[model samples]
Target: MAKYLDSNKVYRALAFIDPYGMTVNWESIQALKGLGIDFWILVPTGLGVSRLLKNDGNISEAWQRKLEKFLGLDRQYIIDYFYQRRSVSTLFGEETQINKEKDIVTKIGNLYTERLKTVFEYVSESFVMKNSTNSIMYHFMMATNNHSGLKIANDVIKPKYKL
Candidate 1:
């Protein structure tokens, strides 16, 4: 990413980590700033699955409604869609889940409020892109949806805080 945009003199970059923002490590942010990006915005979009169908049972109706509202998806039309998922390991079995309501919302907010380390460095450039018309509210919505998953990841990456 830096190589391609470097030549263009694009001094700054904004990576859409997930519509549900990302766990930003300020330490890494300082490092990336050294790479010449004056600033970067983590405009997260929960989980993108444009290749798949529209409706998905794993996701809830309210989740669908919120995602549609954020992504400009029409409410009248329903279709299978994708949202980031997580796994909960138990003594008996592991559960794969997507927490669209309360869980997702906070995982997204931690990007700004909480500080992480390695999670900040991995770009997943294959998945990141630039938004021509970026808005804070939109990014907030995205972050809210991913909050739960991000919190799980945050805990895994920073396990010292775990209960």
Candidate 2:
């Protein structure tokens, strides 16, 4: 998997080929392992960038950089976003418009999820991968930049601490 990773956009990608070979997914999985993580909290699990590239025929550089930043952020917020989130309530806070926007974000995310499912079949699509994931770890961040949720989260979090 290291070979696949080497060609991707991750700035400092790492993978272990010892004892049993490691895909960085190990780190993410560990984060969610025993924290009573429920589906509602984490919603769409997995990294969100490189993984989503295949489906996005013409990705914008801005979007690419955004996901890179998301990966760079600690997974602590990810788990916290879900399991400990008062997130939804705060956003949909007695506001019909917020509810409407929330619904739209959900639908968009589902579309991305469907697109991501077949990414492996098109691994060859990336100019970098060039049909090489058959033997390497690619840090495909499959997480969406779900701006709606992110904004809500940022707002909710700021109240607990200064922005």
Candidate 3:
């Protein structure tokens, strides 16, 4: 699609990326930078990103690769963003422990939104999606260069509970 879009310079598009897991690479999305496109992406916040973020901050190589690819960020950066290090006094000596931050899903959503802003001029607030257990599972967001499109998307993406 990137190649096709590159060849068709005059084509404007509305692109939606629906990934079941951390399958979408940040580089793929970065290819759409400055294009005449309004993009909507389904970020698997709880199911993918949060699941990869271990409580101890000891992310495995595979998980680190997945996160680095999906987020286009360094593993250390992601770790620092999601976890904090605290010193604990043990019997032997002082030890540092890694603690995962609270409300991580919201932080992940905000991170992805900031990433979108790097490519597009305007980004709409996320439309939060939750599971049957009311756990936040995904965040749907829109990125566009057009301000009018962003305004319309912001209005449309609002969660409707009563209806």
Candidate 4:
């Protein structure tokens, strides 16, 4: 896309990025900023991010690196955003325990939307997609420099599925 943008020809593109999981790098999306592109991305909030976030907040180094690369945020910031650190008195002593936040899927979606807002002029409401067991698996969101594109995305995203 950056290559095409450098060309003299005027081009408007509509891109749908549906990764199998949380494999897409943040730099790829950042490259689309200020370009004439309408993008719809499938964020695996539940299937990927939420699952990677362990309940005890003791994520492995590899998983932490993956999250940081995908979300473009610091590991500590991501941990703090998704978990609450509380001091609990154990039988031996006071221990700091990190508890995962409630409704992580929504939080992940909101966080992604906020990140998208940093690059796009207009970001449409998310369309939540659930799995067969009714668990939230992904969020389909559209980002564009044009307001009309946002409106069209809103129109296409059903009310019930809006997040």
TM-score per model over all chains = 0.23, 0.18, 0.92, 0.91
Whole-model lDDT values for every prediction? 0.36, 0.29, 0.91, 0.90
Best by TM-score: 3
Model 2 weakest 10-residue run by lDDT: 121-130
- Model 2, 90-123: lDDT tens digits are 4547422111122222333443334433321111
Residue lDDT tens for model 4, 12-121? 78899999898898988888887888899999999999999999999999999999999999988999899998999999999998899999999999999999999899
lDDT of 3 by residue, 123-156 (tens): 9999998888899999999998889999999999
Flag regions of model 1 displaced more than 4 Å.
Answer: 1-34, 42-103, 111-136, 139-163
Q: What residue pairs are clashing in model 4?
A: none
Native-to-model Cα distance after best TM-score fit, residue 141 in candidate 2, in Å: 19
Provide the lDDT at 18 for model 1: 31
The lDDT ranking, best first, is 3, 4, 1, 2
lDDT of 3 at 70: 97
Ranking by TM-score: 3, 4, 1, 2
Question: After superposing candidate 3, which stretches have Cα over 4 Å from the reference?
Answer: 1-10
The true-versus-predicted C-alpha distance at residue 140 of model 1, in Å, is 7.6
